[model samples]
Target: MDTGLVGDRRWQEKIFTGEWRDGGGGVLPVIEPATGAELGVAGKAAPDDVARSVARADEAQAAWAAAPFSERAGVLRRAAELWTEHSAEVRTWLVREAGSVRRKAMRELGGTVAECWEAAALPSHPLGEVLPSERATLSMTRRTPVGVVGVIAPFNLPLKLAFRSVAPALALGNAVVLKPDPRTPVSGGVALARVFEEAGLPPGVLHVLPGGADVGAALVVQPAVRAVSFTGSSRAGHAVAELCARHSTRVHLELGGNSALIVMPDADLDRAVAAASYGAFYHQGQGCIVVGRHLVHDSVYDTYAQMLAEKAAGLTVGNPAEQDVALGPLIDAHQRDSVDALVTGSVEAGAKPLTGGTYQGLFYRPTVLADTGPGAPAYDAEVFGPVASVTRFSTADEAVELASDSPYGLALSILTADVTAGLEMAAAIPTGLAHINDQTIADDAHAPFGGLGESGNASRFGGPAANIEAYTDTRWITVHSAIPSY
Candidate 1:
């Protein structure tokens, strides 16, 4: 199945010019989510390809590190502009390759590009000012960039998360090596590399490398790589943490979550159902911050369940390319099997499915389960599919208690009319981030993103500031040469 010569309009191979490609083998299939059909074959770097990539990265990074922050940041701005210009084509590939819905994909891709542009403008943003002391002239300290960063993203939100990492890393003048998920290795669309190349970055400053765990591990463990930015399941994230920890490597991991959303007694049922449903089903609930536990205050539980079930019923589940599709298939047969098994195990263990537990092709019905034991896989495991485990609590204190009962704490939503109660509950949730008056996940690019406990470690706040902060090591410049102001 030779797709013939690779054309500018289509990509045949994922490029690797850094040490990530040093040990090189060759290409592997990358499937289109819509049909489970092959879209393109991505290069899987061999041990040697990986070595060469590192060598290139190490060789290329010193100059990038030496480049002026202003000049480096300008490249990110140009890339953002190019991303915006190519939104349509990017969305097309996203819809086909990743099974992302057209409208949602468009918005997310656009937002991702916008954030990258904003990252480029950050060096000029104000921090704080201090008047110098005359005796020996003391001045305020600033920031600097790490030499290189390993930027990785999962298949579900590939471009967005990759942008969350690479844009900031570039802005901070850290040369980057990107490892996109092997499942959806469209490399954030064809023009992604072109955008940066046009943005005027020095050759090798930014490189795209896509592969599986072996490739990722090689990059993370490489001495030339200074930091890692990753998003995936808690189990996988733990492995990343351990590997990096063993070598004292720095990391920012967005790991697995079975996040709980507390909709209090005072919250409107209309809003609560919308939040829970959207939070649970968007991206097929593959999101790390998906609302897996729907902990409603007892006063509104029945109505909330009804609205939720009705909403779930209306979400058209099918192949992504179909005109009527609302929710598409999971990423692959493995995810399909996992979702089905989790739902079946929950049912066998005594949970009741409100409306769904159906599976077809890669599609798992938007499932709603209630009354499962706290320890059952449905409630206990990170259900990376469209399933919700409903639990009721009588008070705000009870809500927090139940929500925090699980060891995972990535992100949680607190929906309530009482602003005071919302803030109070938000403060008590124990998770890294909490949302109020909102059902779905909402992360500002400027705020830190990561988790604690089983949810993983390394807080990655995406944006120019977080970009510089995460990648750079700060050391005070103590000018000891000052002829003592005696």
Candidate 2:
């Protein structure tokens, strides 16, 4: 099988109807953020391509859905095996195409492999429950696939998010049309299709269309597409939701976050510093659940801030393929500019930089901001970069109030030795995922992962339970014995 990364022309083909074809949306250049060089060009899918892809997926849904659970599971397991076989190639693409550091690329590839295998188990997951009936009857509920699902993934962590949605949708016997960010299509989008195709996924059960917002909008409004799973900025997520609403389609969004890491007076300073540093700087702080705010208690705030600043300053920012580089370039110059603007605005608004507030090309330094006020952009908005805004609180109520003061309720972390205090603090916070004595960005394949409020639309996208919910619809049935009277 062709890996599809052979040349510029080969990269310009869309995965549609089980084969590659040059899409109508013309050619888009793929840039490597680390060096600001053109990696290659990818084919962009037009609106017509979107319609055709969805139509094909619609046609293929029934037969795929009718296939036995064991068969579907076998395909998914084979896909996982394929991922393992191609891990090195995928990791290289991630590093070059998406600006992911070696460690981050490895982690994402590993997670994608695990997610596929976990999705394979979705077929064996319980569908629904049997309920007692008032009369001499039996009542039970069952789940069915929601038909063709449209997945729109962002460039950051492209491979992981695409499979995070696509794998489960396929596991539940639903066809999928995935639109990956054009910038990282080869790494994020096409590679996925290669895996499934090699694993013998039926034609049209999975399609990859690489393009911009036009393709995504077309997918969202396609009549055959019953559901949408999106992961990206809150602004884009809201737009996707609104478009899906017009079609009366269900959408599961994993949007932006300004998660906070709270440090209590009795917290272990070393552990808190390490967790905060990793949470805020990992993946160049590009993750949605990154710890953007560090709320330290007044008692140890100065010491903690000092240690965090030292750690942030010591991080190596360079080419992603380098061995010792901890931070890589942002996805593009636009994102780097945005991060710079936010940092500059915060500093102008009375926030002081404790460690870093500089950039070279698309690479932004790991920054720690001190004395950030409520009105500062760094404190109020999602920076989506390697910048941690620190503020001090005197009491637990103040900590909770500060932590819960964001429009994004994605995730939060409470670091304290006392489990009781951590639990109490966790209960008070309004975020979706709360961690005691750990960072906010940790995810397990078996747990439900999503957010509340502006972070998402109450849709979970991890584990078998979430897959069952997102990819299937519940139907309740009742049967009366001996035709009992109503």
Candidate 3:
């Protein structure tokens, strides 16, 4: 479905104050990455737009915070209903504008609904606790909204990434000013605003501004925005953190990952291969938690490599919207070139390309590289592509060392027949998330989702406790029937 041909007027405009309008920056053409065809145009916001959005959200937050908890929960519940009711339209936007495959788009759509439902529960949760005090008084603590929150979302998995923060912020009685990447404004920005708008979100409560780095910078520095939830590259994450730090604003960052998938000698070969293929090639490996390293025990390294290579070669690659292919194009040519450069560099550094090391247009084939070692680009860096670099490890210690070598500590997975051994290995690794007998690309809407080191600020973004902490400030209060001496 070309957005140009769609009849919905909202998709082509910027959403602010519960209404649609042209942006201050002019229009941005939405292009289909797979075919480089113009899907349509979306309003492009300028830096000035960010200021207006933050100012509006700040003014609207007080009334929203004072509304009944039931009203807040009802808004989120209605958003969930709208999400499911308009699933087909959202799926098309994801596939066409965000370059996601059919199944991946469906998964994102379902996850968005789950996020909304999980957020709805936030309004009714116990927000504070009674505390012991030194004086003769009842002391307690309660959470309060942080005024306006700024959400800066990325292109890949845009809908889920944006809403995971947006839904909770709104449910917690705070307004939000969202900045979706210009490359994927519709799926990440317009789609979300539409659902909330139709669900009866009030004016100035949620602003969807589609723009680039300039707009993001403006949003982060706005005095009215007390916090910012950012998801993007580690380089950009660092930049946002620095700006927020200077402004004394809280920041929650979900950045890059070079996750590892360790296969033990005693692992089931078929199951291990299946998990590896899925983790490495899901959404063309555009995800942060997708497998970046394949650490195989020396005893079964040859067998595992052969199996994975065969699986990679057999996957069909085509336009996701038109074909039921296992792999689709990268978001654009720049991403494709970056991925190819890493593969080429790794191969030149003596890594063997077991299946693929080439591409045509944006569709990079699922690649398997054997003998991947230190100093190789694909082995050491977060390539963020459908390239799996396999390295041989003789012992459990070696596997742990190899997986923990990178600066990133986002996610890890171990495939083994011995559950105890897998668990032990997982404990030794420093990642925030780990799986035994499973793959690395795992996320639950109700689970704490984040990472350590460069992957994020350790300020996670899901579940009741984390979301409450992310979107609100806890305050302590004391009650006394009589005046107490100082």
Candidate 4:
């Protein structure tokens, strides 16, 4: 069957144990949000397929773990090289399948390459520590790979997010069974398999199963799957964590976030506005760490709100493939409608719409809401779209309180010229990441990236140091040079 789709044909196959196969779960149509068109169809993995994938990963884990670190690192380096070499193709896939604007697509591709290279270097870095023993013996701790890992990646930034966990898991000598979001199976899942295979990765060391929630559930509960790394919404994260808990499997979750950006009176208006614009609307505010709340000091509240309104109105929204388009369409109609409902509910609750609160089809206007009080859904709930809700505060304490009021503590930004105030605010907020004089959405390959509370499960990802803790198990050993007389 043609599957009634358009775009790349390579995406039609499922990557099973090692080779492409027709999925037993049937076909899933990939829709492009930009024009509401069918981008392609992907072979979906069934529950049995997921189980087979886990078995293959478990079988491969032993040999891969026993392989020398240098050998494994070499393959990762090759994969990184291939990712960079095929950057153009990867970018196209992201734009068409993920509804990523040109710049966002480029950023994701670049980040994927960087993450792979970073993971490749993990073998050369210190993975363990030497400890002083109470007895006359040398004591040290060694980090060893966990067996098989189930990686459930999200649709937004699918390739980058998947690589965030997959590369590190592979670098640490763990076999991974990845289940990418069905909507982005080709760009997110299949492309990654191709990269690893071309880079000489051992067959069965990595498996890509493109499917929906059922496949993810199956992967999470398999006896051989010792750990799981998932990135998605809080509701889904909770479910996955609960499932893993039942099986006594370790799971790392990077879930939903309702971060805030606080603008103090001492902050430069231009810088604050720029920070708010980038933090709140970049990638159309679909990021987990995107600033959902904008808290402004009453002294500068009017000016900041006006400036932000103008900025939101000025942003261009159109086809994601267009170079100049600043905002792209939502992933699908469901998400678009959800965003609309949140905005509508907030407006009805007395939150004033400052600018751009409407939408046509999947492309929602960059929206800004002022006077959004505590009772309004937009004030506390995560919109997960191109929307920013502003609330004015009377004092520094009030600004901090408002920003820290949310149940989520993912990423927070405080814009102020006063270093002391910035430091004070950072100390007060309980988010995983905090920025002063910068946007909240920035991430580095060498930094610990994850969240707190509902945003994450207190587990860290990214960087060699953090991944060493996440993907490996620690064992303490002591050796005696001479026999002790008792």
In terms of lDDT, which candidate is strongest? Answer: 3
Residue range 45-75, candidate 1, lDDT tens digits:
5555555666777778778767776877777
Over the stretch 1-486, how does candidate 2's per-residue lDDT look in tens digits? 234333334445444557877798887787888887886676778999999888888999999999998999999999999889878878888998899999889999999998998999998888888998777778999899999999999998999989899999999999999999988988888788778877999988998898889989999999889999999999999999999999999999999999999999988899889989999998999999999999999999899989999999999999977665999999888888999999999999999899999998888999999988589999999999999999999999999999989999999999988999889988988888999999987777778889888899764787777889899999999977687555
Order the candidate numbers by TM-score, best to worst.
Answer: 3, 2, 4, 1
Q: Per-model C-alpha lDDT, please?
A: 0.75, 0.88, 0.90, 0.87
Output the number of the TM-score-best candidate: 3
For residues 433-461, write the lDDT of model 3, one tens digit per residue: 99999999878899888899989977477
Better of 1 and 3 by TM-score: 3
| Best of the two (2, 4) by lDDT | 2
Name the regions of candidate 4 deviating beyond 4 angstroms: 1-11, 481-486
Return the TM-score for candidate 1, rounded to 2 decimals: 0.92
TM per candidate:
0.92, 0.96, 0.98, 0.96
Distance (Å) between predicted and true CA of 151, model 2? Answer: 0.5
Q: What is residue 341's positional error in candidate 3, in angstroms?
A: 0.5
lDDT of 1 at 380: 87
- Model 2 ranges off by over 4 Å: 1-11, 480-486
Off by over 4 Å in 1: 1-11, 18-23, 125-142, 188-191, 480-486
